[model samples]
Target: MDDPDSNAAQLASPSYRLPALDQDFLLGDSMRGVRFQLEFAKAEEVLRAWGIRTTLVVFGSARVREDGPGRHADWYAEARRFGKLASLRGGAMRDVGQVRDNVIATGGGPGIMEAANRGAADVGAPSIGFNITLPHEQEPNGWSTPGLTFRFHYFAMRKMHLAMRANGLVVFPGGFGTFDELFELLTLRQTDKAPPIPVVLVDETYWRTVIDFDAMVSHGLVSPSDLSLFRFADTAESAWQSLIDCCLKPHPPSDYVPVP
Candidate 1:
């Protein structure tokens, strides 16, 4: 005969567990807000714990390859060199009495993002990558500091994280995604939603050839002052100089404490 005690042991208790623990419930439409919060908080917690007070966000294409494409390879080289320069001089290497500032941050994918992260690595400074999950399968580049790599399912959350602690923006030649990130920051700066920070657009010929900002002013679409929001840099040193000239240098994190 079957053991009656075994039958009782086999019974499951659906009410014993919290509904929030259920993956199906968590993935449903009712839990979308919760998912967003999770995405934001997880990275926020990690970054905070890592002592990242501020960031210099680098926006660029993921398609560029070193020694494989046209002018893109040159762009990659410049981005990497600029990354190293920024990390070395932007207070990236934390000291006993000072907090790290303006650490290299990227979209956390291949191409220029990889170069920037690799550049930071060259100086052994920490870097960040805000990677977004795509339907087509994109992953974080290998160069970003391991613990600082974050994957975000929500683009809005990812964008928020990118802009929140940003002290400056370094944009390189790219396609639609790059344009979106650049314009998003520009729009924020124009509206005073984001404070004035140096926005350096690398490769003057590429930018001018792609979009005619001067024409936008000529057409009276945007005010003349809007044109002043961004400047062009042809090399790594010039990019660093532009940040200084624009008074966009980063400050220590608000919560930083001085060591005795």
Candidate 2:
């Protein structure tokens, strides 16, 4: 017989044990959300090696193939190229687009995330990936720094980490999850919860169709000036240049301090 008090305690303080890679913990049809939470905690340990500060998040699609005239490849190549340029400034200085003090960050899976991480690795610069644990295991990209690949169970915590470490955000074409992330950041900025950092969206064709900024203005949904929140760039050169221009400008001292 199970004690009611013991059951209550278990519910209040959920505890989980890590299973071996081959083990199948899922039983029946029910999904245990807490499994992800535990996995996230386990992955956080990996990020401990790279303190979560001064990071740039490069987000895009994971399903994107490596070749075949895809914008995905273009996005990755550009990120890598810019990362190498940034790394030349040395690890001690800030890349503010050229300073190189911050690590390039991404989701640990493939596609755009892989591109960003690959870019950093190509330049021999450190990169960080905050990967999610799903029912289907998603492996870290080949370009990820050996020790820097991190896995996470909690989506909220992962987002928090991204918000905490990011000095800039570069977004590329992706799916639903990507939209969620982009909007979350936009909301945070609008609410004054986050400082205004450079937000660059790659691929003007897709973005223009997806986001009707002019319509929003026409409907009085948002102020026209609010459209300045993001800078759209079609090519890698334009994206890198936008970051350089923004970073080279003198940032207000208050904005430079890390949010506690």
Candidate 3:
């Protein structure tokens, strides 16, 4: 019902958009490669701006609660304590100008992830939560620092962010997702794609019952040296200490900077 000239004018207006405003175009397969770069850069830019030089990834079952269940209760407590200890000792609680190292990072959901991020919060330090969309609905734990929390649609991109700045990886009792991350690091270490950072599994009892790394070695399926790729810790203190022993030197001077 409009004149041809007015119709043409409306079409040329700013309100008339291109494919840039089309969600279908952006989410389509043809734009996947662009999405990948955006995913990588988005997290990287924020992390860099925040001065996150190193990261310590904490992985575990989302089902574990702070108290309700038995072993779950114990693990939740231990993970929380470990988060505090790691943040205190690893430099997350240092003054703004001080060197920041091993900033606590987690899957950014409840369970052990919340415990770890909560520990860092206890010390009034910033922590990171790398969460992914899931069928069952996983949300970022509230304990993680506000600006540092991130959500990703792609699992590969999510894992990339986890490992990229990782200085240590600590795994607690968990199932498939935990195992996926745990073994991915192991494989990267095994294949020499990753540097030998400390990889500690919480609770010797749980880990031993779950998998037989020794059996794998005995069967010649894996070399005996492969077993050294990870070790076990029964408490938070021991776990954080092992990371210091395995990869980090004693807390450096506040002003210390590595000479390149």
Candidate 4:
């Protein structure tokens, strides 16, 4: 029977047992879904390329306006200070010598993120920013250097990049995202999945009221030594000095030659 049209119609219909990917039976917007999936893959590749090293991750709020008060302002201001210092030292060392490669990195958005990026740029030092695409928030701050700013679709991958490369983590006062990052890093170290990288909780006033490390100890959820995983700092200078002491010791196990 000459019924080719009818046969084609049956093959395309849902009732007919067909292949897995049916353009008709797809969920949500197909273009949007595929875009996100591609983005996720690209992000993983970008993060993996950075490799393991002594990197610093600065987690903070993206909504922090250039001006604010209390914790928000303090976090951004301190980030700026420390970022610039790190950049300067990095530049100086890389120019004629190779002391270390502790590049300052951030979430690649505004607020404290901006402060950190700004600081790095201020000293003309290359930095990294793991930018996430969001409809309402999370745009790469102006301070993020060209070629160093990257966007990620998966929060987990972005966070993984941060932890994998970090020799230390400096967390500024922030909301849910900040707390999530802080806990994850602490968990990794406590669980022995990751090395004991120095975690500095900036702004003691804000941090103390927000989360109780003692409470974790009180409930027997964590050991007393877990408290040693982090320390409190109030200023950029203090925090940078802490980093110098902790991560920037002479590499290669060789004696450090002081600058004459």
Global lDDT of model 3: 0.87
- Candidate 4 residue 156 C-alpha distance from true site, Å: 1.3
Can you write out model 4's per-residue Cα lDDT over 1-260, one digit (the tens) per residue? 76866678777568675424654534336555665566666645553454313567888877676578655666777888878766565332243234335677888888888899888787566678888778776678788766668887668767877777677788888899888888999999888899877788888888899888799899998889888888888887777667666655423213323222
Ranking by lDDT: 3, 1, 4, 2
Tens-place lDDT digits, model 1, residues 173-206: 9999999999999999999999898899999999
lDDT of 3 at 77: 91
Runs with alpha carbons beyond 4 Å of true place in candidate 3: 8-19, 97-99, 250-260
Task: Point out where model 4 deviates above 4 Å.
Answer: 1-53, 90-100, 250-260
Candidate 3, residues 83-159: lDDT per residue as tens digits?
Answer: 87777677676566555678999999999999999988987778999999899898899999999999998999999
- State how far residue 110 of model 3 sits from its true place (Å): 0.7
Cα RMSDs, all models: 4.8, 8.7, 4.3, 6.1
By TM-score, the best candidate is 3
Pick the winner on lDDT between candidates 3 and 4: 3
